[model samples]
Target: MKFSKTLINWYSINKRDLPWRKTTNPYYIWLSEIILQQTQVKQGLPYYDAFTAKYPTVFDLANANESAVLKLWQGLGYYSRARNLHATAKHIAFDLGGKFPNTYKDLLKLKGVGDYTASAIASICFNEVTAVVDGNVYRVLSRYFGISTAINSTPGAKEFKQLAQKLIDTKQPAEFNQAIMEFGATQCKPKNPDCDTCPFNSSCIALSKNTISELPVKIKAAKAKKKHFNFLVFISEDEKTIIEQRQGKGIWQNLYQFPLIETEKATNFKSFKSLIKDHELLTNQDFELLLYNKEAVVHKLSHQHLYTHFWIIKVDKLPINGINIENVRDFPVPILIGDFIERFNF
Candidate 1:
């Protein structure tokens, strides 16, 4: 049997009953794809259901507050995807009359929609004959073909994408696309796939050549930058706390966080005092230190590792900018801050 037919036959019997696979709805497909970008299906599914339940349509998502969207997206890291998803929803709802672009080429124009995403949306929703190439696809192809090219490199991407495009079953583009991706995700997994019963086991290049473990070569990613964060969890006599929206193009852009003091080194009580006084942060007598979090929140982002310590501060009066504890959840905040909020004593 040919590659596409063999894969499709296996998929028909083995495909997991995922929520997103049950529909041709572009919005749901787009949402699932975005949420699953840096996350696994298990982690992204609940988020997918939550978003769809909260915002049933593109117009609903577009009309909803950005803060609300981010809050719902709290723990699913890669906050930029949430922001972009909101932006694209608005574009589709308002600018494009709530219609998702039907072609892969047009879908690529929306914010955060990349080639693979556009292809998946286009082919799956509109039956456009396009191929999708993601990490799973990369793994499956490189191993089956015994290709040695680094999957992250440009030449490798082009080569694999072309091969995938050639093999797409144009008659049932959606089914074909989903089958291959599902096959890759389940059968040709990153590690220890059950090759003994795999349909392609006999013809799989990596298995035949005894190089399954080493076929899908990938270069090591650049080291993540480490930074120290001391967050002032300021509370007033009324129990109100302080938070500010992250501005500019930083990691948690548009998300709310505490008054942050990023330092060249991890800070202790003495170091905190020096940082505050030297920076002329607060009036000496107005604020008092109540306590510090017994443990620091060590949050790992894609390219940055943040060692964060939350310092509890008691102030005579609320900062003109602070919000009531009751209203703090309304604002969008990074998951790191959300975790701190969930654990801190009011």
Candidate 2:
């Protein structure tokens, strides 16, 4: 097809020299794909380098501690992705006998391995003809073909997937997938794309119809839920600090953070003072406020908007059975906690 041919030709001349594209190693490809998901290239590139440099192989990642893995993934939001990546790595190392799954169907069985990822790996590593559909592919195809279906809906996904499959260069699925995605990223971008110079501009339905800005319809996400977090940071006289590992089925699970007191909305100073005075553990006269953030620290997640305030309290004595914190940097913390710690020299 001219669309695939022209796009592939453009890709041959314009594709970026990414590290993952240099090898057929499924291990590296899997890492890159996982790290890049819901992440931008420039932001994720350093993390990919760090992971490959430290872990080096699937075996290394599989054997490494969860804290270490999550620490390396510190700034990357979506802690679940890191957890799943580690789980899948161990499964491949122990359960699969260090062999990467060669087929799209088999790869999908791995944790966090969905259709797009499986297809990318299967095509790039094993030369499978599976078509990969991602955000980039959706935008490119929708604009090119003037498909207005909501890409997130079930029917829209199926329609786009079928269209992509039909247009794919079967003999070179790997290159085709990469080419279409790259085209979307660089040429057929989501906004303000330079269509005048595009190879497909003459035939692009969206460009011709003056609807380049809104071709790929997607269901609007619900507004993020707002939450209030008041962290009580206790550092003992001997430089010991209190940090607890998050255990619930929420954001930052398994990551460390200060002792938190959550409320429905932002807590004012008066209510906070009463809470501190009434609480059993906090009312101990031995502790004094060292640092209190009067300004609301806002942290925005995908599904939640957190208004955080930190109170760094100095304690004269460490409580009985209190956890010992030697190095603040040793623990894996959420991006919000990590930023607070780093900025305040904790």
How would you encode candidate 1's per-residue C-alpha lDDT over 9-29 as one tens digit per residue? 888999999999989999999
Per-residue accuracy of model 2 over 176-294 as CA lDDT, tens digit each: 99999999888888888989789998898998898888878999999999999999888777777778899979889999988899998877776776677655555556557644677
**Model 2, which residues run further than 4 Å from truth?**
278-280, 321-326
**Candidate 1 residue pairs in clash (backbone atoms < 3 Å):** none
Please count the clashing residue pairs in each candidate, in the order shown.
Answer: 0, 0
Each prediction's Cα lDDT score? 0.86, 0.88
| Model 1 lDDT-worst window of ten | 277-286
How far off is residue 171 in model 2, in Å? 0.5
Best by TM-score: 2
Per-candidate TM-scores read: 0.96, 0.96
* Reference-based TM-score, model 1: 0.96
